[model samples]
Target: MLVAPFPPSHPLAWLDSHAARRREVGLRRELRPRSAADPMLDLAGNDYLGLTGDPRVIAGGVDALQTWGAGSTGSRLVTGTTALHDELERELADFCGAESGLVFASGYAANLGVLTALSGPGTLIVSDAANHASLVDACRLSRARVEVVPHDDPAVVDAVLAARQEPRAIVVTESVNSVDGGLAPLRELHAVCRERGALLVVDEAHGLGVVGPGGRGLLAQVGLAGSDDVVVTVTLSKALGSQGGAVLGPAAVAAHLVDTARTFIFDTGLAPASVGTALAALRVLQAEPDRPSAVLRAAAELADAAGVPAPASAVVSVVLGDPARAVDAARACAERGIRVGCFRPPSVPEGTSRLRLTARATLTDADTALVRRVLAEVLVPVAAR
Candidate 1:
């Protein structure tokens, strides 16, 4: 086999064309770093329980850093598995009512690990249309036939599963849709999967620590936790105030992932500091069971201010239908000393670009009032128009 020589052209020139196209479509983005002591009221971040900067969480990270040094030093299969990792995994599993759990470098990696490890050529994946990008990517990488059905429609999922020729199938969805904050019909989906003999994989990244009793997770709330046919994936970076991901399910699933999940076998283990921080945050949630309700209340307040429907979780999305308008509204809010997220294509579909406002359990009445005022000024007028 003779290999042809590369074309005589600049290898990087195509990037400039792509950049120009993005700029023309109002899709170009830039990074803006924040200072450690910034005073802006933050509603853009995913710190739902407001534990990211809590003294206890900070102390936990500091302790882990002092004890374990900077990094894990290698992959988990090598020399990276610390006592902190083990404890974090066990505690997360126990909290979520799962028989076992396996931690990954990040939520995205966890999805990739579990989906690819569980499904292959002989498997089929029924994915929700509105699932997170990570789950979409995982389905693509799983080497399985994927059927994207309408979001939150268990009937379509059931129909697809019933017609699949593959010997095995997996139904993938988010317990709470990350963009629109819509809750999935989990019980219905579970029932469909059970009838079809398919496994259900729920990404609880946005649900864990915000949508269940004592922040256990949506699975526990819906009476499906620890089920042999269901698997849950979560991110520590969200409500847990840390930086890692985990897959929770039966002990057999964890064992299989440990043996064959490429992401887990190849990537460096999560940092010990993140493990310790997440553990402390979980303990705080257990001690302060009201935190989850507080988050929901804050989200409702934010939604009412924005004139959007009540959110199912901590995310309150106010769709502006145009990317430029959403960006301007977000900028206006920031100018008023309130920081909120501005999501546009391709984070969302066209005509659904919007502001993604996340509520924090620690937000006070004054903070809510301030946010309401800001949204009234910045978001309401545009939404009305």
Candidate 2:
């Protein structure tokens, strides 16, 4: 039998088409490398405590580099587990009032590890509608039935868990919504989970350094920190101003992740330098318990300047509705020597494009005043219009 010749198709032609579509939709993204010595006031980064450049944090990284070399050099189960890693994990778990902890290469990895390890086929995972992309992706990869409930709605989550046919169920949420800085009702969620015999996993990425007493996070604030049914995930990069993530919960959960989490088994361990830096930053936070409150105050000030409601965490979101308007507003602020995050879809929903301003504990009154002036001149007109 003779087969007709197939029509030729260009594999890479779709790339240009997609690029054009993104540009047309005002969704094209590009990287703008920033200078280390740039004088711009930064309100875009997640260095909540401003310890990323602190001398103590720098010294800790340098010391670790000198002692353990630059990298972990292997996976945690291989040759990567160092003394610094163990120490950081222990201290982090203790700080959060958890029984044990396991560190991962990134917060994304930590979320992936814990969710996948704790849930599988025949399990039900009830997630919040406004969870971070990492959690959304984790749910897709968990091989479990996932039900997305309304954001911060414990009733919906409880109903979903109660109605599930799966014998084991997990409820996952962020302690603080990353986009709008809304606080989750952890106590209510935990109660619902307990009544339904489900486990609660709270991602404390935003709450770790910006909420609760001494920045112990929302879980701790709600008296669920050490609960057996509650597990927590946090990023060292945000609050600790380091470069790793961790899962904090019962020792059994940590052990389970170590044994079953592919991200943990196949991925390289957190760097020794990051481990040391995070340790130092945690100590600094413990000593200077007032830093978290400073961050909240700064956020409130930023929100007030933007003419938005006060934030519950270190994030002040100014929604401008249109993507182009949001971009222009962010650019205007940048031109005035203030840097802020311009979030467009799909970072936020359509028609909800926003300027995401993050607060740092080290931001001075002068910085806040400058930010206020810039927002007044740039954001106010756009928001009002």
Candidate 3:
């Protein structure tokens, strides 16, 4: 490989001096951890089921803590394998309609493991342009020939797969695009992949509780779950209101991942508390799937009442058209005791900035009304500016 060290002097040494320029442009981000006592109308998180604070969830974690102690101790292949891990994997696979499953410490790592393990040097990866950053980065790291098709355009994906020299290819997409909350045509895309003799991988990070029948996710809604060739990745951190993630697929594929996936083999297993919380939330979703629909309705109504209708999901994005204004709009909402997420360049693929809002099942009609008022006030300043 190589030896190319930077000389003692290079020409463009001024790049490091521009850190202040980013702050001046309002592009700088800072961390402020939300405490349980913060009296704010929360909408910036991914806890769509509102199960994060549920007594049952906390109780389950407490029980697991008593039983399994604190950490998983090591990677899944090593000393980390516990009864909790096995039980969570079994239940998640059953819920998602996959033959088997593997849990990861985090969803980001799960995506990395699945993509990198499945694709090799000669593989072709047809990915949606608007996929999550983790998936996009996975493609880059896979060293596979990547062809990013237009968002949700199965025809473009079909074309790319059709032209591939190596049809031993994989098609990667998010069932519900995270940025716009727009759903991809899963059945149609599945059929296209099948016709082209390609494997399909669906990221259900946003769809697990927000779409599909019984809140089983898009694969189940579209009747493609448990297929011989389909694979699914999901984050327990989202609607489940817990922590950790999973990769679901055929039994053979899951076994292969166990033997080869770097992320699964090298990373620590999920915490005992997170696994317990997720188990509780999954049971809750199984018991009351309609709660998600109610949240989706509230999200739709909240956006409509704001005079800025978003898509039909828990994720509601109010487009601000410019990055700077989007940040300012978010600030306005925060000042009013309403926390909202700001989407800007690099995070948003469309180059359009927005205020990203998530609707949780715990948000009542009264809560929706409050959010409506906040949106009206915050978005007004955006329009004037």
Q: What clash count goes with each model?
A: 0, 0, 0
Task: Give the candidate number with the greatest TM-score.
Answer: 2
Q: Is candidate 1 or candidate 2 better by lDDT?
A: 2
Specify the poorest-scoring 10-residue window by lDDT in model 2: 1-10
- The local lDDT score (0 to 100) that residue 78 gets in candidate 2 is 99
Judge candidate 3 at residue 300 and give its lDDT. Answer: 80
What lDDT score belongs to each candidate, Candidate 1 first?
0.92, 0.92, 0.86
Clashing pairs in 3: none
Residues 208-300 of candidate 2 have per-residue lDDT tens digits of 978998999998888888999999999999999999899999999999999999999999988889998999999999999999999999998
Kindly report which residue stretches of model 3 are placed more than 4 angstroms away from their true locations once superposed.
1-16
Residue by residue across 145-167, what tens digits does model 1's lDDT show?
99999999999999999999999
lDDT of 3 by residue, 1-385 (tens): 2324444475644543454576676566778888879999888999998999999988999999899889988989888889988998999999889989999999999999999999988899999989998998899999899999888898898888888998489999999878778888988889999999999999999999878887888888878889988999999999989998899989888898898889999999899999999999899999987887877887788678667666767888878787789888888889888898898877884458888888888887777778878877778878888
TM-score ranking from best candidate downward: 2, 1, 3
lDDT of 2 at 75: 98
Quality of model 2 by C-alpha lDDT: 0.92
